[model samples]
Target: MNRLDFLKHLGLLSAGAAILPTNFSSIKQSPFTELRGGIGMFSMQGGTIGWYTTDGAIVVIDSQFPDPAHAFVEGISAFGTGPQKVLFNSHHHGDHTGGNLVFENDGYTIIAQKNVPALQRTAAQNSDNEANQAYAATTFENEFSFDAGDETINAKYYGPAHTKGDSVIWFENANIAHMGDLVFNRLYPFIDRNGGAMISGWINLLETVAAKANSETLFIFGHGKPEFGVTGSREDLLHKRDFLSHLLEYTQKGIDAGRSREEITSRTSFDEFPEHISPSNFLSLPRNLDVAWLELTNS
Candidate 1:
């Protein structure tokens, strides 16, 4: 029998694993990997941060957590004396925007989608930290673009995918797209249903965004499995799309068969799509299944 046939016969290749690296704390240093068009991605914690230097300005996308944000601030300062610093929030998620204060304190202009501040404020309030939270003062409805020396960085909202506030930050000259949590690479993704995530719509948006990108475009993912890392191309975006689509389809199929929430989500895995097994973000696959179930049945 063929490998696929043998797997079917043996009932092997069941569920996938969600694996988290055991050495997260050891990732303290701020490592910068250069991409196309004088842009780079930096990671300390919570979503990858994208930075660019071309003209006389520096732009940073997604400010990770507070401590890491401080490290990022110091790293960018060493790049040059470009006093014009701008920080962007890819969405209202704390991991991606918790460090807004790191730049705000230094007089950097903070930017994000219009819905971000409210979500940030609500999240802060939940933690009883509304008084100390840093939110983007500059907001855009759909598209925002600005020139920083020789490059024009652009931010555009694709309308409620990862979150209602999700925005795509693009380096125009370099063709590098910072997908935020919109593209989780090989890892299972966090479906922020509470934050207005639409799995079906999100799948469509993934294809929409992927369509805009060319073969040479370099995409930076918000998170990825330990082995996959956080950088890829159009194929990476489509891979994520496939995962979400399969999750939605699997959940709907169970629902159509009169399955309860637990009955549908209790499955060890979506046997049809086992490529995204990561014990690191283990909750994502099952959580996404639950969210998709609720979205299909309730909404």
Candidate 2:
């Protein structure tokens, strides 16, 4: 078969294999009919972007890959009676910030962490640049809070995860926390080593958030559906810890056995959590494993 045909077949196979049985009765119904302080996950592959509506204005968190970003903003416009006041970028990744310029031109105040502007500036100067840098404005260093009608959304920068300048936004009154790319849910996290990301710091930060969350807190990950009133419980936190622990142990074992990187990648499989693995999982796994190995072994 041709390359396009092969990819199409692969997509169908993956979709069929990944189907999970759902209990319609047990499915938690959303509290609001209209989009409130929650996320509307587009396609399965699309990044999870959040929309917060308060008073008449709306605040969007992270724009999906470029084209979707425009569509997302347009969708929000239909629901919003008021204007779009702000478009908050969770990080500097293209998937998150691609729609920045578009939204900025449409009169949205694009807010992000301080490092984001610097990153965008660097990108603009780079030979491989494509992103519009004019979108970024109003960056915060440590923390900032804004009152939206009855709710207050607090933006804070933790150490780093996913990328160097990852920002986590917490809705104080709504009890909702939007963890940019910090918590990848079940998927293998993309740690931008070039962006000064450290696995240890990332894991540690997640632990801190887990401790802070309660039963009523709504946990919204960067790439997953929002969980209502179910923040990271002690048990859930332990599961995340265990996932990282296993990755570390397996990687070390491969290294001690004098296995090549390719061999290590092929051997290690997160089959228990198939959702975590990508198509081949080999390429990304080695890099991800290498990062975890370096962090654990060196520390």
Predicted structure with the largest TM-score when compared to the true one: 1
What TM-score number comes out for model 2?
0.75
- Clash pairs (backbone) in predicted model 2: none
Clashes of each: 11, 0
lDDT of 1 by residue, 275-296 (tens): 6654433345767788888899
> Candidate 1's C-alpha lDDT?
0.77
How well is each residue in 1-299 modelled by candidate 2, as lDDT tens digits?
76544533243222111321221234354312333344333322234567776567777777655455565666665555456478888887665665677777667888888898777566556635555655567988888788777778888887776677888888777677777767655545566766677766677777777788777666666543122111343445445556666777787887898876667756445875554544334225666887766665673
Candidate 1: segments with Cα more than 4 A from true spot: 1-30, 280-282
Name the TM-score of candidate 1: 0.88
Q: Tell me how far the alpha carbon of residue 165 in candidate 2 is from the true structure, in angstroms, after superposition.
A: 0.7
